[model samples]
Every structure is written in C-alpha cells, then in structure tokens.
Target chain A: MNLTILGCYAATPRTFTNPTSQVLEIRNRLFLIDCGEGTQVQLRKNKIKFSAINHIFISHLHGDHFYGLIGLISTFNLLNRNNDLTVYGPKGIQEIIKLQLKLSNSWPQYDLHFVELTSTESEIIFEDDKVIVKTIPLKHRVYTNGFLFQEKIKERKLNVNAVQNYEIETCYFQNIKSGKDITLEDGRVIPNSELTFDPEAPKSYAFCSDTMYNEEIIPIIKNVDVLYHETTFLESEVELAKKTMHSTAKEAARIALQANCKQLILGHYSTRYESIKLFKEEAQTIFENAVLGDDGKVFEL
Target chain B: MNLTILGCYAATPRTFTNPTSQVLEIRNRLFLIDCGEGTQVQLRKNKIKFSAINHIFISHLHGDHFYGLIGLISTFNLLNRNNDLTVYGPKGIQEIIKLQLKLSNSWPQYDLHFVELTSTESEIIFEDDKVIVKTIPLKHRVYTNGFLFQEKIKERKLNVNAVQNYEIETCYFQNIKSGKDITLEDGRVIPNSELTFDPEAPKSYAFCSDTMYNEEIIPIIKNVDVLYHETTFLESEVELAKKTMHSTAKEAARIALQANCKQLILGHYSTRYESIKLFKEEAQTIFENAVLGDDGKVFEL
Candidate 1:
C-alpha cells in the first residue's frame, strides 16, 4: 500500500501550501481523501490519473475539506468520464453538489452517487472482495467522519516442495489454496497446511482529520499499520486548537501512542508556522515513529 | 486604468494554465472579474490585496467562471473582513452561493450582497461617482454577460497658470473645477474654458469572455480603450468554435476591428494550442493594436 500527499495545509490554501487532500493506493485502487480548493490542480501536478479515482471521501463540509468537489465533478464530466463515481461525506454534501451542477447546467454523463453518512457509530461503508472501509466517527465543529481502510485476508500460497512431496494433483490445487484438506488417490488424507503456506498479513490504514483531541476513535483505529492524524497546531497554540476543534501535534502523537499504531503521519498544519519540522519534532517526542506529512511526500506502508 | 490577468485560459484549469479570471483597477477601486478555481491563490501570487476588492463581477454560471467564488468568500470570512462585498452575476448565482455558505456554516461577518441580473438588454449594473459598470450581453451556451468598465468624465483641470493670472480665490476653486464660470468681486465674469483646460479623456475597458463571435456587442463596447475578448480557437478550429459558442482569434479580431476599439486583448485560450503567439498574430492581422492577455501580465490602458 502507498499514500501520496497532494496537500496537507489547513484553513485556507496558499500559493505554496494547499489545503487538505491526499490520494491512497491500496490493492491497486486509488481513493481520494478530503479534496480542498486546489486539489484538482494538485492532482495534476502529482501525476495521478483522474480516471483511476473511483471513490472520494470527504471528512466534513468545511471549505478546506470539500470545496473542490464541484469543480472536480464538473471536470470529470468535461473529460467524458463513463465510469461510476462515489462520494462519501456528510449529509449536506449531496445538496451542495447537486445545486451547483444544476445551476451550471453541466450534469455528469456518468453515474454520480453520494453516500451520505449520519451515523455516529463506527460502521462499514464500503466493502469489496479485497478490502473494506469503515467510518471512524470524529469530534469536530461539524458532523465529521474519518475513514479506515483494511485489506482482507489473501488466499494461502502453495509450498512447492510440500506439494511435490505429497504428489498433489493439479486439479486439487484450487481446493488446497482455499484451506481445504486433500484426499489422496490411495484413500489417505493430507492436511492443507502441509501443502500450503500461510497468507501474508493484511495491512490497514486510518485517516482522521479536522477533529479535536478525542480518544473515542482509538478503538476503531487500534493497531493499524499507519495512522494519519491532523495536527493543525503546535502545543503553544493548544488553546486555539481547542477553540477551533483542531488537534495539536502532541495530542495526535498521544492518540497514536495510546492506540498502538505502528506509524503516525502528521498533517493539516496551520499556515502560521513557518516550518513543518516543528510538528514532526513534537509528535516524535511522544511517538517515536512519527513523520511529517508534507505536500508531494509519498509513504510506502 | 490598470488590468491584471490572473487567469486567461478556457474550459478547465490545468497545471500551468488557469481558467478565466482577471482584476480590473479603475480610479483606485479594484473589481474582480470571473473568479475561476484557485483565484484567491492567484490573487495572492499577483500581490493583489484581497481587502481592496469590494465588488466582484461573474459573467456566467459555468464552473470555470465562478467555481472559486465560494472559497474566496470563505477565505474572506477567515481573514475577518469587515467591509461590505457585492457580487453581480446571473439570476441563479445568489441561490448557489447562499446554499454553499449555509451548508458550510460560514457566513461572513461582512455584509454580503448579490445583484442578480436577468436582463437581456445592455444595462448599467453599477454606478459610482468616478466609474460606471454596464452589462454587455453576449451569446453563449448559458446566460452570460460581459462587463464594461468606463471611467466617468473627469472635472476640468484648473490650468494653474490661468487661475493665478485671474487671481481666483481658493473658495471658488471647487466651483471652477466643476466647470462653472467664476464671477470676481468686481462683477467680472470669466468663462470656465478661459480659467481651466479640458480634463483628460476618460478611459474604458470591456471584458467579453466565454462567448461566440457575435456582432451584437459592438455598439455596447464601441471605442473602448481596451477590449479583452475570448479567443478559444484558432482559424483551423473555426467550426468547433461555432459549435461550442466560443470565438476564434480571427473572429475576435473582426469584432475588435468593427467596434473600433483602441486595443484588443485576446484570452480564454484552449489548452490544446502550443503557443499563444498565434492568437496575437491572427488578431493583429485585422486589428493592429491586438495583444495577448497572459497571466500575471498587467496592462496600463
């Protein structure tokens, strides 16, 4: 799995720094997260294929989070997109998008679907054969949800030596990979474990942003391979962070530490700070495996 | 009068080329015209003060024309703007803006006003002491209008040497500047023309974009000092331009020539072209004072 940071700044987009937006590549599928105002341009700059994105997840209805949705949808229509596109966001997102499309008279030719989320409980919102996505209810000034993506268990791999020793038939290979025991031609039973090796461990990633320092999400994102949390402020601006329903770097690190995440990625920095190194330093003081999420930075998980 | 090209391409914003947007400065007042996506960031990059823009004119409801408006307004609120802002656009623009603001829950602290226009005829939309703005109705796929920014006739110059010879009192200077004949204490009446010289001729600029090659706007924009016209196609794509309701460089030049404009600025170029010089070359074939409108390029009219 890999993640590309298109934009990671907060509140408003600047000339050098963009607002919140990123692209996650999991199991050969690309998912867009939190499209800010200049996200489409950032996507172009990052060289990510626009058609590769089939799903977009918006954390909230704030301008910095979802203002680019309409423009993106319009551009998709202009590009003659034929595949279906799905957007998962707050309840009012559908109205905002539909209204703009109607007024602009540029409705998409492809099927555009909106899955409005209002549940405060963690629930599965997307599920496919290889992966599943669940909502991590977050505390913010508005109704918000962070997404958790987890890969499903893969099929068992064949142990070539063990299969040859057991003299397994080619026709029985499918059953053996499905964890089924094989019956030999001489009426002897062979355990599946003897012929096959265990599957690779599944990986998981959770994205949380534009939220306050709330520990309620720990259970939903516990022990994930990678946890990306918003750190809109430093410890010095803790009071401002609280008032704005944003988290400081130290607070995000504390959550990452308590949740037992393997690695923590810090982002959504306020433009007031001249350097993003401060966020990584503060986060690392609490969690050793913390890294700063700068624009155009890619991480292999 | 000064005009700044913030963005001048057509259809969609790209990595290097932006969509339609510009800033017109007349008599010390700034007017934002056609705010496409990333316009706020473009404004910052161009060093234009956001607070100086009190009025915004949106030509149509297309995404490329006004997608950045909501984000700009939200940014204004974030910056704690206290001055009033007025937007003039098509009839449905108010609904589109108000719905987004309501969903985002970020109403501005400043007074936000919208002037909805539904008239098909050319009419004055804004008038102040120094300048007047009129809607130059154009032919487009949607309801669209071009803006004409014209400086009002200035007061006659005092002709400092003539005033001193006449021994004009300071109290009557204002009247003299207002083009009134002055009466001395000895009951001698001096003609206003003898005391003052004629004021500099007023300058005018017309912005026509996202429209076809229609001659209906000639009367409205005739003899303007500067005319910025959309040139979305070259001569080879004339049929496509006709079908898309856009203008070619040759056609834009034809209109400028017929209208007798002092100078023609060509913009709204399609990204398919490798060079913008072709537009100026084609336009200059018919209009000698034709120029290309490039992003970040300023023009003194």
Candidate 2:
C-alpha cells in the first residue's frame, strides 16, 4: 500500500503550505481523503488521474477538510465522467454538496452517491474483496472519524518444489492453494501443510487527524502497520493544541506509542511553525520511528 | 486605475493555466472580479493584501467564477478579519455560500453582505464617492453580468501659486477646488478657471466575459477607457463559440470597435490553443489597439 500527501498544513493554505488532503493507493484502488482547498490543482500537479478515484473518504465537515470537494465534483462533470462515485462523510455533507449543485444547475451526469455517517461509534463503512475500511471514532471539536484501511489476507502459496515430490495433478493445484489435503489416485493422501506455505501477512494503515489526545482510539488502531496522526502543534504550543482540540506532536507520539503501531507519520502542522522538523523531533522523543509528513511526499507500507 | 489579471483561461483550470479571475485597483480601493479556485493563493502570489479587499464581484454562478470564494472567506475568518465584506453576484450565490458556511459552522465574525442580481437589463449595482460599478447584462449559457467600474469625476486641481496671490482664506479653498468662482474681501470676483486647472479626466474600465457575440451591451460599455472581453475561441472555432455562448477573438474585437472603447483586452482563451499570440493577431484585425490579457500581467489606464 502507498499513500501520497498532497497537503499537510492546518487551518488555512498559505503560498507554500496547503491544507489537509491525500491520496491512498491500496490494492490498485485510488482513494482521496480530506480534500482541502487547491487539492484539484495539487492533483494536476501530482499527475494523478482524476477518473481513477472512485471513492472519497471525508473525516469531518470542517472547511480545511472538504472545501475543495464541490469544485472537484464540478470538474468531474466537466470532464465528462460517467462512472459511479461515492463519498463517505459526516451527516451534513450530502446537503452541502446537493445545495451547490442545485443552485449551479449542473448536477453530475453520472450516478453520485453518499454514505452519510451519523454514528459516533466505530463502524465499518466500506469493504471490498481486497480491503475493508472501518471508522476509528476520534475526539475533536466536532464529530469525526479516522479511517483504518486493512488489506484482506491472501490465500496460501503453493510450495512448487515440495509439490513436485507428490503425484499431484494440475487440476488439484487449487485444492493445494486452498490449504486442503489432496488424495492420490491410489487413495494415499498428502497433508496440505507439506504442499503449501502461508502467504505474507496482511498490512493495515490507520489515518487520524484534527483530534485531541484520546486514549479510547488506541485499541482500534493498535498494531497497525502505519499510523498517520495529526500533529498540529509542537511541544511548545501544547496549550494552543488543547484549546483547539488538536494534538501536539508529543501527544500524537504518546498515542502512537500506546497504540504500538509499527510506524508513525506526523503531519497537519500549524502554519505558524517555520519548519516541520520540530514536529518530527518532538514526536520521536516520545515514539521512535516517527516521520514527518510533508506535502508531495509518498510513503509505502 | 490599475488592473491585474490573475487567471484568464476559459472553462477549467489546468496545471499551469487558471480560470477567469482579476483584481481592479481604483481610488485606493481593491475589488476582486471573479474568484476561481486558487484565487486566494494567486492574491498572495500577486502580493495583494486580503484585508485591503472589502468588495468582491462575481460575474456568474459557474464554478470557475466563484469556487474559491468560500475558502477565501474561511481564510479571512482564520486571519481574524473584523472588517465588513460585501459580495455582488447572481441570485443563487447567497444560498450556496450560506449552505456551506452553515454546514461548516463557521460564521464570519465580520459583517457579510450580498447584493443579488437577476435583472436582464443594465443597472447600477454599487456606488461610492470615488467610483461607481454598474452591471452590463451579457448573453451566456447562464445568467452573467459584466461590470463597468467608472471613477467619479475628480475635483479641479488648485494652482498653488495662483491661490497665494489672492487674499482667500484657507477655508475658501474648498470652494475654489469645487470649480466655484472666488470673491475677495474687496468684492473683486476672480474666475475659478484662472486660479485652478482641470484635473485629469475620470477613467473607466469595463469587464465583459463569458458572453456570446451580443450587441446589446455595446451602448452600456461604450467609450470606456479599457474594455476586457472574453475571447474563448479563435475565428476558426466561431461555430463552437456560438454554441457555447462564448465569443471568438474576432468577435471580441468587433464589440470593442462598436463600443468605441479606448483599448481592448482579449482573454479567456481556450486551452486547446498552444500559443496566445494568435488571439492578439485575430483581435487586431478588427481593432487596432487590441492587447492580449495574460495572467499576472498588470495594466494601467
């Protein structure tokens, strides 16, 4: 799985800083998350195919999280998109989008669907054969959800050399990969363990942002491959972070440490900071393997 | 008066090209005309102070014209803006903006006002002591208005040397500047023309865009110092222009010629054209003083 950081700043977008938005590539599917202003331009700059995105996951209704959504939706219609697209977001999102489209008199020619979220509890919102996305209830100024995307476990791999020792026919290869014993023509049976090996373990990624220090989410995101959490402030501005219901770098690291994720990615820095180095430094002091999330940076897990 | 072109392309924004938006500086006031996506960033890149802009004019309800407005408004609130802001646009604009703000729950601390337009005939929409803005009804696929920003007639300049020669009190100087004859204590009347020189003639700028080849607006914008018109196509694509309710470069020049404006600006070119030079060449065929409008290019009138 790979993730592209399109924007990482908080509150407002400056000349060089953008607001929160990113693209996640998992199992050959492209998903857009938290589209801030200028995200469409960032997509063009990054050369990401617009049509490749069939699903959008929005964490909340804040302007920084979804202001660019309507424009992107309008551009899709302009581009003659006829494919089905679904947006999963908080309850009010459907009203906001439909209102603009209604007033503009330019509704999408294709089917547009919305999976509105009202439950404050964690729940699975999207699932495919390859992956399942579940909401991680987060504490913020508003009702919010952080997504946990987990790839489904794969089938067992055939031990090609070990299978050769048996008189297994080509038609029985499916049974071998399915972790089942294959019986020979003379009624002698071979154990499935001798013919197949376990596939690589499935990986998962947890995305959390714009939330305060909440210990309840640790259990939901614990032991994920990568946990990306918002670090809106450094240790020096802990008070501001608390007042805004945002997490400081130290707080995010504490969550990461408690959650015991393999890797921690820190992002969504306030524009007041001159550099993002302090976020990494502060986050790493509490949790090792903490990396700064910068715009245009890509991370693979 | 100064005019700065922010983005002048037609339809949608590209990686390097932007949609329609511009800034007009007149009488120490800055007015934003049409705010496409990324306009706030363009304002910052152009070094235009956001606080200095109290009035915004949106020509239409199309996404290209006003998609950036909510983000800019939210940014203004984030910057702690307390000054009042006024927006003038089509009838449905207020509803669209209000809906988004309601969903985001971010009401502006500053006073926000809207002037909705639905008339098909020309009318004065905004007026102050130094300038007046009127709507120039244009034919388009949607309801659109072209703005005519005309500076109010300036006061006559005082001849400092000529004024000192008379025994006129400082309080009477206002009367002299108002073009009234002054009377000395001895009842000797001095002609105002002899004591003062006429100030420079008031200059006006007419912005017409996203319109077809309609002659109805020629009289309303006639004899303006500068006329900026949208030329969405070349003469070769006149049929496309007619179908889209957009004008060709040649048609824009024909309007400039018929309106008898001092200068003509051709902009809003379709991205299909590789070079912008062709627009100027085609426009100059009908109007001698046609100039190409480019993003970031400033004009003084």
Candidate 2 pairs with clashing backbones: none
Interface RMSD of each: 0.8, 1.3
Pick the TM-score winner.
Answer: 1
What is candidate 1's lDDT per residue for A245-281, written digit by digit as tens?
9999999999999999999999999988889999999
Candidate lDDT scores, in order, read 0.93, 0.91
Residue lDDT tens for model 1, B159-189: 8898889888788999999999988889999
Deviating ranges (above 4 Å) for candidate 2: B161-166, B183-189
Q: Model 1: DockQ against the native?
A: 0.82
TM-scores, chain B, all models = 0.98, 0.97
Root-mean-square deviation (CA) per prediction: 1.1, 1.6
lDDT of 2 by residue, A55-94 (tens): 9999988888998899899999989998999999999899
After the best TM-score superposition of candidate 2, give how far the Cα of residue A125 lies from its true spot, in angstroms.
1.2
TM-scores for all predictions: 0.98, 0.97
